[model samples]
Target: MQPILANELCKDLGSFSDNPQITGVITDSREAAPGTLFVCIKGERVDGHDFALAALQKGAAGILCQHDVEGVPQEKRILVKDPLDAMIQMGANYREHFSPLLLGVTGSVGKTTTKEFCYAVCSAFGSTLKTEGNQNNEIGVPKTLFRLDSTIRYGVVEMGMQALGEIEKLTLAVRPAGGIITWVGQSHLESLGTRENILKAKMEICDGMPDGAPLVINADNDLLSVAKVPQRLRRVTFAVHTDADVRAVGIQGDEKGTHFTICDKEFGSFPAFIPAMGEHNVADALSAYALATRLGLDPERAAQALANYSTTGHRQNVVQHCGVTVIEDCYNASPDSMKAALRTLADYPVCGRRIAVLGDMFELGEISQQAHESVGVMAAQAGVDWLLTVGEAAQDISRRASQLGVNAVHCSDKAEVLARLLSQVKAGDALLVKASHGMALETILEGFYKQFQNTTGVQDKIAGECKSWKNSRF
Candidate 1:
């Protein structure tokens, strides 16, 4: 962000301060540049206040500090109750200078994919600036807002949260002109405790929306239907199952790609194609199509742009390992997403065996066991040939698979899983690796990739050191 005087920022935020013009805002002392304003944030591991002298020595023009520091000059410091709050105020201040249509997106799943789709569609309409690389949290959101400058005609921001009020802070910072709630699901249920609470937290994105701004919603989510969205705000609904303003029908996919039909209120039904899997993704495409249409992009052009949309890494991305097809969705998981992945697996034509390498879902709180077991039952019912589970909580999934007479293996660690999978998987098998981001299932995926390369005589094209056990030559 451009350097602004401390006095100017205080005026924009409506906060009282003696000195206003204090250069740039920075969170890390190491990144503090000359004539910049350093914000000393107390985070989980590091305390920024302790680095005040370091930042000043690095040429920070001013500091936003939570506590008084002895070495820093009093005139160059702006004391606030909370540094995070101060950062939020700065974002609000920065936002006043830009006149762009702010599009905000949130949901239990598909937020990132939907955000990408929105960026693609909006880019076709005007100059766009979007969230780069999962910068959707407390720190990331404010940082993203600061990146918005005068040239950006439209701003698409992805807002994520684990608890209540987080989205409210972000929405207030950007004051989005439009919003999209992808779908309500069982993610972050550990902290949120219940689906109802999750809905409330996601709906907080609308708390700071303008009175007449468009708030797009998924009519399929029962909780969202009952959300206390403001009466003054304009509401737009999209769905795949029920009749809505935007809908996807006749969806079809294979190992190669997916094809579907998009029906809109004004444009009628149009064929839309995406190089991705899962019906949920088709729904996400519909949301993007609707938003783009509302923003004045031609329906045909928006659908064409969506057809070019491809899945990002680790989110249902398909890879060929030797002769086997591997679906590497190891980025993250929840009960809803797990079920969706299994359904996709079920739809694929498997010549030999269909295997799922599952891991703990995490953050389900007291219901973790039940949630895992529920996914186990889903895998069994979906006709998975074998179920391999990792972590202590995932034992419930393995047990449920066994109870349903499905071949299930429970491993305490990656080594045990590799040993078992190496013995069972053959050339014609299709395997899916999925778990919460915390489980680090990508390590297990890398192991399988190495095995495939060795057995099938396929060299690793991606150059990097193998971080785990060496490839076991059979």
Candidate 2:
């Protein structure tokens, strides 16, 4: 956030203003330092316009509001048709000043992981600032861009959308020089209706790419396999299935971690390892490898960076509790992600019962039942000993698992799931708690830890371990 005057911001946004030396742009009144320009955004839970006076009272340079505030001095405000659009425009304007090489990433799944991978690889070359946490949407994207400083040599922005043209708006704001689409899948298919529509929505990130910028894509995805790129852009492809521009040979993963080799005749085969579970992460690694190589990093150096990088919170992080292992992958879920998590579960060495606590996979739309059933079948095929599913939509999973001859129970809520598992789940059991972010399955993980604490009378020891686990980024 290098400070820029309002006049300079207006030049970037292509807007006309009589007073152009506005100091800074802020979204929250709480974050409005003195001499800041506050942009009032209308959000789902709160409206920023309501806090205009509060921002002004805190020494805001000016207000970018949708409408006039009742008590605030009218002369201090810049009225706009839409404050969100104004924020985007201002972000674009602000971003253009620094001109860092922007790398845009999007896909139905693995966007965050790929963002982390890209950050890891790019950091080897120079200072890089990537999208923080899961900040990949319109609001999050702008906030991420605002964090950019003068020392950053590259900016990796993850773009995510559930509807058409959303990525286009973000692409316009980012004006990325390079872009990567990880893969197209059933994620957000409910909103976009079909895979074709999903592909179309995902490709919107390329709308603002420069004419000669490179557009990287996964060569394995059926939708992206035969897709054509714009004539002005160069295409680089990567795959784990077939020979491509960047390919991962001998890909392998276990409960401990995943190991693979990046095959490149020019740089020779380099072994890469990530202390994370799942083959999907291998795909994410490949995308990052391709992007980093394109940005002029040594293949071996980039691979080493990825190998040293660890998983972030709630995404396949393994926690050992009193002889039991819990794979806490409850961050978010989709049909594709569920299958990937199930595969990781299958990879774990099990001496006792293999258990799974799954919740609803939201946003499946018309295909919700079929998706759930497929996941149930997958659970059975993965040899899960006891399957506990919560939520109405996941009942299909239980039914399908039953048809496949797996011991499955459909719980009405988390309470019932915990009650059913309390007696059955014993020491040495491997449990996986997974669901979409809205399901809050992490609460169930907390409940399990509490039970372990109470039964062992090792509450202090367990509390210390849980605290360390909670603070652990991976």
Candidate 3:
């Protein structure tokens, strides 16, 4: 963020006594330095206020705190009713220092992929900053803003929320030029209760847009297709199954990627292919295209940019290891993404068997059992040759698949899951590894390769890590 006088940024919070030169904002004291504003956020495990004195000791210009810290000088502390909100406000203020066509993306699934695609298309025009990985929450939103400067021409952020009003807060801070609500699902039903609530929360991305700004959405979604959007905003729609402002026709997918004809009512249609698997990905690519074109980029250039799209980290990223085709989508999961991965693997042309290694899908609340069972039904329907599941919640998947005549194996922990997979996996098989982030099922995928190298020590270390994860987080 550009440097500014502290008094200018915090005039409404309280007195600007002994105002400091604010160079940037930080939440971690370890990264604090001169002219840095350390925000004291009260978390469930660690309290940021506890690090206030440590931040000042490190030459932090000032600390934004909810209350007084014991050894910190009163003048060095910028008190507030809530430091997190104050930091968010600071981020919104900091955004005024730069001019960029900022865009926001949010949904129960696919927001991260959409964010990456948005960045790719936007960067074709100029330097663009995007949310790093899946950091789409409060802290991540403001931190992404702090990366802004005069050099960035476009900004794309994925806004995630657990309940109502969260995305509104983030969207307000982003003050998006335009935004996309990917598609609502059951990922955070634990907090928001119903899909109706989820759709409402996802639409909050519109709250930050200018009156005439475009708001893109998935017209294929039954809820969003007919749902009311703010009257002042221009609505843009993308889809594969339904009529939309922007749509894909004759969609086809191979193990390598997908091909589709881009049909648009506004910018004109063109042939497009995204080098990624699944119809969901095609939808993600189209959404990115619609959002970019709505922002006035050349339609064909935006369509061409989809060709450069690739999976990041555990998000549908394919790995060829030990002569096995591995789909390592361990980043996070909802019922929608889980089925998407399974269908991709099912459609995958394997020399021998198709195996799916699944872990628990988190945050489903009352629907957790039904969600896991539905994934199990999807696995059986997809003709998975073998099923290996980790964690107690995923056992539901095993039971449902086994009842449907699929060979399903449920393990108490990742260690057992790895052992079963190692015993059954052969050179000709394709493996799909998926789970929520906390379950850390990627370790099982990593451990499978280690066994091929005959590294028992590393294998044991992986097992121990899984045990620790099970004992702690799971």
Candidate 4:
């Protein structure tokens, strides 16, 4: 981060200080260093004020705190009623000073991957900074803003929410120049209740957008396909299965990646490839391509850069383990993303059966069973041969698949599921492992890697190759 006067940080507190220059901002006190500004956060488990003195001892230049701590220089101390809000206000103040072209992204399923595609495409034009990992919440957005400087030309901020008004707060912090709404789905059904409410919440990304800012949306989603946008906001639609301003046509995929033709009304048509499979990923690429092109990036060059796009870990990572093809997509799951993974699994050409080992889909509230069963029906329709599941909610999936005459098993124990999979899985089969994040399905992937180490040396390769791309900083 560029150095800023300590007085500028305390501007929200109606105070000014000329004694210090803060070169960096951090939330954790342990990360404090010389020329660093520490913002004390009161988390559920730990309060950061207790560590403020520790941070000062580590050479912090200043501290933003709700309460005073002993041993801090009086000249650098800035008091605020709410430190989080003060941080957001400071970040917004900093953002307005630089005026970088910011692109805000919000969605149910593909926000991270879509943001990654935006990073890869926009980097072709100039320096770009994107939200790291799942840092799309109130705290995360401020951290992302803190990283912005004069060298950055483009900023991609991912916004996530579990209820209404959360995205509004984040957008107000970002005040983006452009926005993208990847397809809305029933991700947070527990709190938000329905897809309609989810759509309403996701649209809040534009609540803080500037006038005349282009708002890109997925035209293929059933909800977004008919949703209305504010008249003052420019809406750009991207689709793969419907007529829209931008589209991906002639889509083809394999275990390697997806190849498609990008059709834009203004840019004509061009071939593109993303180094990731699944049609859902194609939609993500289209949204990024549309945003990058609108920002004056060469359409062909932007499309070319997408070929190097890599998905973050556990989201459809294909690997060869123990001579078996494993699509380790167990990062997180929703009904929409589960169906997309099933389709990708079905599409992969395999000499043996296409097996799907699914776990529970969390946060569905009253519709959890129906949502899991819906994925079961989708798996059957997608031609899944063997369906193995864990968790009580996934029992519905196994039952539905069994009723559909597909080979299905609902295991009650992780050990039993592992033993069954180890006994039956062979070299030629293609397997997909997915579930909600709380299920910790990655443990199963690790167990598979350990159990297969005696048969093949592919475990080391999978670990080395499948590191999450979330750490990539543009």
Best by lDDT: 3
- Best candidate per TM-score, number? 3
Q: Per-residue lDDT tens digits of candidate 1, residues 1-474?
A: 665666666543333244545556788898887767788888889999899989989888778787789898777777888677777778888788778888899999888889888887777777888888677987778788888777888878999997888899889988988789998888888798889888888888888787777778888878766566788887778887887888887776643567778888878888887777778777788888887777667998889888666566687888866667788898889998898899877766655689999999878888888899999899999899989999988899999999998899899898888878877776666789999988998888778777744365433321112211122110
Better-scoring candidate (TM-score), 1 or 2: 2
Q: How close is candidate 4 to the true structure, as a TM-score?
A: 0.90
Off by over 4 Å in 3: 453-474
lDDT of 4: 0.84
Q: Candidate 2 — which residues are off by over 4 angstroms?
A: 10-24, 453-474
Model 4, residue 429: displacement in angstroms? 1.4
In model 2, pairs of residues that clash are 6-20, 6-22, 7-20, 24-37
Q: Which of the two candidates, 2 or 4, achieves a greater TM-score against the reference?
A: 2
| Per-candidate TM-score against the hidden true structure | 0.90, 0.91, 0.93, 0.90
* CA lDDT of every candidate: 0.80, 0.81, 0.85, 0.84
**Residue 128, candidate 2: alpha-carbon lDDT:** 90
Residue lDDT tens for model 3, 178-271: 9998888898899989999999899888889999999999998888888798999999999988899999987775444677789999877888
User: Least accurate stretch of 10 residues (summed lDDT) in model 4?
Assistant: 465-474
Which ranges of candidate 1 are over 4 A from the true structure? 10-24, 226-228, 454-474
Rank by lDDT (best first): 3, 4, 2, 1
